[model samples]
Target: MPSHEGEDEAWLPPEIAVTVDLVILTLRASVFQVLLIERGEPPFQGSWALPGGFLRDAEEDIYDAALRELYEETGLEAGNLHMEQLAAYGTPGRDPRRRIVSVAYLTIAPELPEPVAGTDAASAFWTPVEQVLDHQVSLAFDHHDIVSDAVERARDKLERTPLATAFVGKSFTITDLQRVYEAVWGVSLDPRNFYRKVQGATGFIVPAGSERRTTAGRPARLYRAGTARTLHPPLTRPTPSAAPEEAR
Candidate 1:
């Protein structure tokens, strides 16, 4: 019989590593921002990157790994966050050391606390999305592409899902909700038109039997998230040409 050792080795597939990258988004000071960390290790050492790491053997699921890495790198809890797997990127040369298949996750939350950098990160901080997208700040690996995808996902969800509520408190004003849309869409919506559309979207919000007054304006009614999860008829965004000139 011919030697089978070489044949067996040739049939074995090469091992590839899996990592989880987080695009943790929040509305800060009316601007959309994402959490990023500076890598403490080589292969993009000192470069800013999404908070994430490789899947550990102890983690039974990819999501568990994502949560663990997020906390380990940024010290942010995964509690009550609107999180979902955004996409998978597995291009051969994405990682310099070896083959890496990264599963990117998108998370949205309201008023997160300041981040503390962990062992794998030199420093952690929130950076505005415009700076990242506009290349004012450089990101390690293919994180720029990942951020773009996450932003688009968020914008789409805002149209048909209750995702916008993730950026607000239990009881909030219509203006608060409108700010979320404006920040994510990067456009100014006409206040009167936005208020009307939101009220018209049945089951999108429920009056909470309360109102709060602002120093500069009349009392605004408080509302809570409604029972319906999806918008009946999606609240579509205006096209560039149709959007208000001031918004441009």
Candidate 2:
């Protein structure tokens, strides 16, 4: 190849494709699940992967592209959802088609409605995170790594933020909140201790002036999320050795 006049041609940039992938997570039935889609097109057709797509416009911001892909692939809106940039995966050969770089996003929300698979996805559904992590189910591209990172991020966020409440309704019981932590962290917490810690956390939750009666237990006090977004004195997860003793 010939270089243009007055142009430095020592090196040339490689052609790369940029895309977005979403690891949408939620706590349902006390299990952590992630949204995955079966790719409808080639280069991994019929394989399960995180819901995402290439940037529709070169001028679009990465985050905006993520939101658009999320909605387009899964029919889930990004409004009122807790979404953040997770990590970038650009390892060569990560994508079979070409040198594709992916910017992944993580989302946490309460139980979302059944997703309608869009043009890019043959099918879409929420699958337990354990299944993906355990290799019980396969994922397309380098999505396995993306999902793993998203789960860890979610667990970390729950310890220092009011994110757990996103798993439940506006007004929830202390038990309801505790379950969210247990599901995401994959450990049981002491009921009494968890209650005390949550109540002590300044502005984490405020009493909703109501109670809900369970099947066999007495009425449980209800609470609504408060002003505070992050926890000052974080609710650290109890070690496995200490958890058993604390529960007693």
Candidate 3:
């Protein structure tokens, strides 16, 4: 009976097509930013959209496909990139082309070079997150939902995961780390309390043997995220801003 079931499974057609989409976020000019690409072809020509592509036969893993799409669209070579599966957007009408279900990934980077649009993209640029949320900008497909999901995931992760460090450079001041939290969470934190909380959270941070002076203050200490990726005794949270919560 098991053999028969396995044989039946082998003969079944792949009901859903697979694709990879990326929600790449970064900070530019102290503003939360997202990478968007302009569509060069029909279906949604001239509109902005997330960087993605169809999964080919050679790519056997979803994670690999996602990284490939990221590099292909943005010339961002995959390294120790902070990446995670965001969500699966599989609504039947989400795509006009067949039954394509995209496995979206949220990738955060400290710095991204200027994006060079590739075969499927007309042009690409980093757009501020505020613009996307306020509907001041339009996105192709259900990408707006994808982008929203990514932001919320990142915001929540900042509280319980060491994900906030991705926004800071190789070495960063404590204030710089605080800004990453503020930008994503959209809540201003009490500086003194935030400092103490992070320090008390075991393995959340470690000294980088570096220091730098700020414009209006004394020399500030520099640190990097510790090897322990998960935040123990998670960071404290302030009140959530009066923003409409998108339905997940």
Candidate 4:
């Protein structure tokens, strides 16, 4: 691996540029959504693209650059965000202007205040992943693949990591937690088992001394995400085949 200064100077080919992209996900309408901005310039103009920008000389760190790009493209401040370096994409001929390598990051937010596009973007909005994936996306550069990778990472995180807790409010209910699971997993879980499993998980959630009665039927206790960032003994996912092979 090249040093930071070397990567910026000698390693970067003139035809290849470096940029940072962010995949910001949040829960809206009880479904998971990703933020996309409409590109205004050429090279996939008028197409939806991830919020990103080229690195500047003043930017010292790649992670810091990504956070800055996130705020620049979408006027939302990086609040208690669960952000991590997702991956780097460098496929030859990915960008028309030049060969571009993009460092991607995944951001999970509770509830976004609002998004205002600036610079290379025309407008920004929170879009359902299904709606965006359903269409043929010829995005700017290799963004389509980058976004796909980010989405898959988020899905896998939801499986074993306590990432879904980021979607819930400071204080939440079993139903609220259930909704996060449902939205991320895209599967309906048995309410009884879901409740039992969640309750059994040590430090997965803690009570905040609050209660709310959902219109559904019963009054539910409210809780908050525990200090634990991860589930020690990760929750086991239900496998499709639980029975032994049939006897011949």
Cα lDDT tens digits, model 4, 35-87, are 88899888888988888888886445788788788778665566677788999
Pick the TM-score winner.
1
Q: For candidate 3, what is the total of clashing residue pairs? A: 0
lDDT of each: 0.88, 0.87, 0.84, 0.77
Q: Using Cα atoms with residue i matched to residue i, what is each candidate's TM-score against the true structure?
A: 0.92, 0.91, 0.88, 0.84
RMSD of each: 3.2, 3.1, 4.9, 5.6
Inter-residue clash pairs, candidate 4: none
Candidate 2's C-alpha lDDT?
Answer: 0.87
Query: Tens digit of lDDT per residue, candidate 2, span 151-241?
Result: 9888888889998888788899988899888888878888888888998889999999999988887899999999998987899876778
Ranking by lDDT: 1, 2, 3, 4
Off by over 4 Å in 3: 1-15, 241-248
TM-score, cand. 4: 0.84
Better model by TM-score, 1 or 4? 1
Model 1 lDDT per residue over 1-248, tens place:
55656765755567999999999999998889999999999889999999888887744589999888777755566776788999999999999989999999999888777888878889999999999999999999999999999999999999998889898888999999999999998888988878887888879999999999999878999998987788877778776677785343
Q: Write down the worst ten-residue block by lDDT for model 4.
A: 239-248
Query: What TM-score does structure 2 among the candidates reach?
Result: 0.91
Off by over 4 Å in 2: 1-11
Q: Identify the superior model by TM-score, candidate 3 or candidate 4.
A: 3
Task: Tell me model 1's lDDT, rounded to 2 decimals.
Answer: 0.88
Where is model 3 poorest over a 10-residue stretch in terms of lDDT? 239-248
